[model samples]
Target: MNSSLRSDANTIIERSIQAVLPDEAVRRALSGRKFSGRVLLVAAGKAAWQMASAAAAQLGDGLSAGVVVTKYDHVKGDIPHCTCYEAGHPVPDENSFAATQAALDLVKDAGEGDTVLFLLSGGGSALFEKPLVSGEELQNITGQLLACGADIVEMNTLRKRLSAVKGGRFAQLCAPAKVFAVVLSDILGDPLDMIASGPACPDSSTCAQALAVVEKYHLTLSDAAMECLKQETPKQLDNVETQITGSVRQLCAAAAQVCRQLGYEPVILTDQLCCQAKEAGSFLASIAKTHARPEHPMAFIAGGETVVQLTGKGRGGRNQELALAAAEGIAGMDNAAVFSVGSDGTDGPTDAAGGYVDGSTRAALLAAGLTVHGVLAENDAYHALQKTDGLIVTGPTGTNVNDVALALVR
Candidate 1:
């Protein structure tokens, strides 16, 4: 393995993550905004704590009662007067329902002339949920959607229909009070109505659209859940303003800058990347194979989340699967390396952030009596990458933008 190349890649990724942190983005988005009367804060999702903390720092005493619900371990410290709660993610638990109810009450009680500042980011769908159906039914449907490889948009479409605060219902609950949201988008294209299931923005999805997603995924839902899916989400929301503060586009650009500094000609392939994890890795390897030169190193960067269809019981996330697939394409090539990371610093249910692999990775696996095809076929990239020291573990990065992939050929 080329240690220098791996180090450079890690550095590039770290810099990329720093560029889109919720604190800086929130601070910039709220600058020059004037507010009247009491300001109530409701922050939700993976970056809720960071976003709320930054806003509290800026608003100080102007900020009144507040509540934050985020993924487990996201809370860094106290946010002055805000009460922070860690909830379940990728799946909702009892805490998810409880915390969401608290947020709903806070918004519902806001009177006229009051300002509701919502700090939203990715993972809100699972992190903040008040289901129209039973919690067990909601969990079952979510698992079915995920196992069948439903994309974020499709999954969220169904979620909006089954949720109380999502799909503009939260904004509706705030009524006469002015609502302003600063969002850190983790969705491709930054669809304002889709991020975090559009809690405070107008939802454009229809009941028919949600039903279509269920049909597309062949999802089996309980009668109650199915009945809820037929209900329309809030289609229009008034007295609400929104600003998209961060996205994968900025994440990719930041990585490109670091690549250039490392003496590589950076090529940003796409920030809208979305596909099967293994297929995306193979595609990136194709790019490296075509452009790699001995004289000039090249860095290919892409950003966006990918889906994993769980066909195997083996443990692995999409990013790890992607890198392991790339290892196959660049097995014998020298100075070719590939790495992918979830901007939130966790991939799937694993503690590892993602995976990294290079030309030497395949041979190393063979020496350890492991084969790429075997590991990937079982969907066990985590263990395979661990054997080659290719796992990238960065616990709870305190932010969530999206997933990023980088291919370096030198």
Candidate 2:
């Protein structure tokens, strides 16, 4: 019975990922749209290659010049009529700077009648950036923001001010040319200004908000980065059309369907679950504990991005930590299981998509001489899950819609 439940959980997660892939979403968005003149493609994010490849299939020979910047190893293969570059994600590297420069150059030369097809997805804020400050200073500030436990919105609020191409600046660079952005949103509320720092959409975040984040986190920034934070981002954008092709809401719906098919009563807890990683895990486990029964089977689904305040020096993503915490909460509930996975198939800096924990997970760890509390306290869920075979390694799924977490009770 436990094995069957695990299989069902995996199937639901896979269905959720498939539902939000950029390929189908981009193709559907471009079905009736027609461009008169040249189409310049610029894509950036974890799903950049997949989205750009899908758009290329539709544009055919109409695509003039294009640039694709994606996370390292996310570039599956060559994108026809487009140059693909792999860059750092969660943190911008030197390659990210160079590739973003190329993307800006491609859009800068767009003529009056041309169309700039911006293929955006999650992680673009880091994958596509030309900093207003030096590369070293930019990297330093980004590291500080991440380690400071700031949420995506808070981190992006500061990023918009620090980047030369963010906060509608990229759209401004492509002035006179119509800009249409097909986005695969990984943001909690699907805020256009927050996704990828709103390179092609107007930024609603002000310098004051950015400053507040810095003060809240007590982040120490370089002089140049500090100065950039005081400057204003572009609050207005011209000739830009933004369309959200995929989101966490869609991901949760797909997972719920799969759960129903698997003979579990599907309950969507919330599609906009925003909280600390461990807190989210504990909450889901609490639901599982309440519903766990021999005769009753239920699946609780939640989707959204979760933040993690890094207090330990050990390694693990937010999803991994969430699963570990759930393990503790559901330790004695024999029929309960909880799983969390990022839609992009890479959570935090780890190769694992996320983590999974069953009622036996905690005991299994103890049998193996591992302490759940100690592992979680050190933020070492990756190694702990690996020992218990709780790590879900899906590699890159070529999609991004934040994260989907499910707790099943039988």
Candidate 3:
């Protein structure tokens, strides 16, 4: 029965990812739009290669030139017309700097009669980093932010101020040319200007807002990074056509479909679910407690990213934290389980995508001599789940649509 539940959970997650792939959604969105001039394809992220390949298949002979930057292991061979550059992610390296320069060059060379197709997905922020601040400074600030447990939005707010290409600067690079951005949103509420720090979209965030995030997180920035934030650059949003081709809505819909097929009523709690990881987990667990019964099977689904304020050097992501926190509240409840995971199949710096917890989780942990408080205190939910054999490890799903959490009450 446990195996069956795991399989079902995996299926739901996989289907959610497949539903929000940039290539698939972009193709559909572009079907009606007319592009008569030269088509220049520029894509970046963990799914860049796959997105590029899909665009190429749909574009066929229409694509005139192209370039893409992706994470080191994500590149899959070379496209005939597009230059594919593999770069570092989560932390920008020298290769990411070079790739950003190359992408800028490509856009700079685009003519008024050309159409630039910019494919953006999650991880683009790290894969194509051109620092407005020094590389060393960016590295320092990023490390501090990670260790501090700042959420992705807060981290990205600082990133946009530090980056040369982010915050719609990439779109500005293609000034006179018609730029169409196909974005796969991985942020809560599918904020087009926040996903990947809005490389090709207009940023609504101001320098003041960026500074505020740093202050709120109590993050110490390097001198160079601080100077970059102080620079008064007017917000620019012109001649760029930005559209959210995919998002968490796709994931929720997919999960809903699966629930229906399984003869369970699926209630999409929200596609914009956002809050502190542990708090959100506890809230969901409470909701499950009210709904769960022996005779009725129901699935509660939510999408959106949650924040984890790092208090310990534990090896876990927000999803793992959510699952663990929920476990604390639903310890003795039968016929109920809570699962949370990043849609990208990587949560934080850990190999496991996320973890799952049920009424039996507490008993299992105690049997294995694992104390819940110790795990939670260390932010080591991943290890706690591991002891109970509840960690869900799915390496790099190649797509991103934010995070997903499901509460199943049967």
Candidate 4:
């Protein structure tokens, strides 16, 4: 491919990924549904603002009242009908506690025939934090989990037990009222009860399972948090009608279509990819190396979340770590490039969305006196990739479809 064609392909890929936001997909799904009763909208996530806005636009005067909670930097668009609140992510703050309480209050007194619309997506777990334990205790436990590099599922398992609104508690609150959940899945396989700690779905995980997670990671939780976990159990409700509107499968399918439109052979490896970030990266790198040749121009795509067991106090998200790890496997192989990014446009605690790496990344880092081994050991892929201008920075995309990793061979 020529320079112009290559650039066009890259742009197409990025645009296609961005087009699959949860709000857009949810709007499409709700287009035909009609209800006579008043619609009460309640949503929470990094993409909650966008999702709520789209729903409001579609619902128009049909919406009675609404409330949504999202991350601090993720609020976007306008929804005059719904109240929007911003809160901390990865770790819940006082703002999160207040927002969650308000959301619960909004639905607490719903009449038997009232209709409740619940929009859920990634980062909702942190955006609406109502701890069964004390606020300080929840904060400390959250900090410990982040430091330990627990994956989203494991972290949420523990979060559900120690919260007043997580697991199936939210659904139980809206009992007898007709509840409809519009979800943007961020978990591998789009587990309904895992995303956003399954606020509006049945939680299959038990307190015993949550305890196992804490013990497995050696997480030190405060006495209050531990007691909360031991004492609390989410009430299951069967009246909720849940629907997942967007996920990794949707994003990967869109990406594959774009690649095919650009006249490249597109192959989807998996939409449920999970494991260590580095191991996943190496796996992608191996595929790229095998397919990189003059006669074969191919695009391989995979979607899902990866875990990083943090040993080093470095700044990086799973996508950055995956890119850095793949660099080692694809070293010395020309005509191969790999790009991995979170669909949400924010990876971990850092600002950058993700990172891009190629066969030349290793040499570039070494030239700058950066040791890849040391950086990977400390989970500092962001800094290492930043030195080489490999970080893919896109502010907040206002969408969550897990993470997308692509390998291009030409």
Clashing pairs in 1: none
lDDT at 30 for candidate 1?
Answer: 80
Which is better, 1 or 2, measured by lDDT?
1
TM-score of each: 0.98, 0.98, 0.92, 0.94
TM-score of 2: 0.98
Candidate 3 residue spans exceeding 4 A from truth: 32-36
Q: lDDT at 134 for candidate 2?
A: 83
- Write one digit per residue (lDDT tens) for candidate 3, span 180-296: 888877877777778898877777777897888888868887777788887644366777887776678888888889877776689999988878888888888998888867466
lDDT of candidate 4 over 1-410, digit per residue (tens): 12343364457547866778766687886889886676889989988988898889899898888998998778775686788899998799999999888888888888787888999989988887788888888888888887776878888899888887788888788877888988888888888888999988778887888888889988888777777667555556777888888888988888888877776788999998888888989899999877768475788898888888888889998899998998887777667777788888898899988888887889888888887788899889988988977888878888888888888887
- Superpose all Cα atoms of candidate 2 onto the true structure and report the RMSD in Å to 1 decimal: 1.3
| Strongest candidate by lDDT | 1
Cα deviation in Å at residue 24, candidate 1? 2.1
In terms of lDDT, model 2 sits at 0.89
**RMSD to truth, every model:** 1.2, 1.3, 2.2, 2.2
The 0-to-1 C-alpha lDDT of every candidate, in the order given, reads 0.89, 0.89, 0.81, 0.83
Please provide the root mean square deviation of candidate 4 (C-alpha atoms, Å): 2.2
Cα distance off (Å), candidate 2, residue 308: 1.1
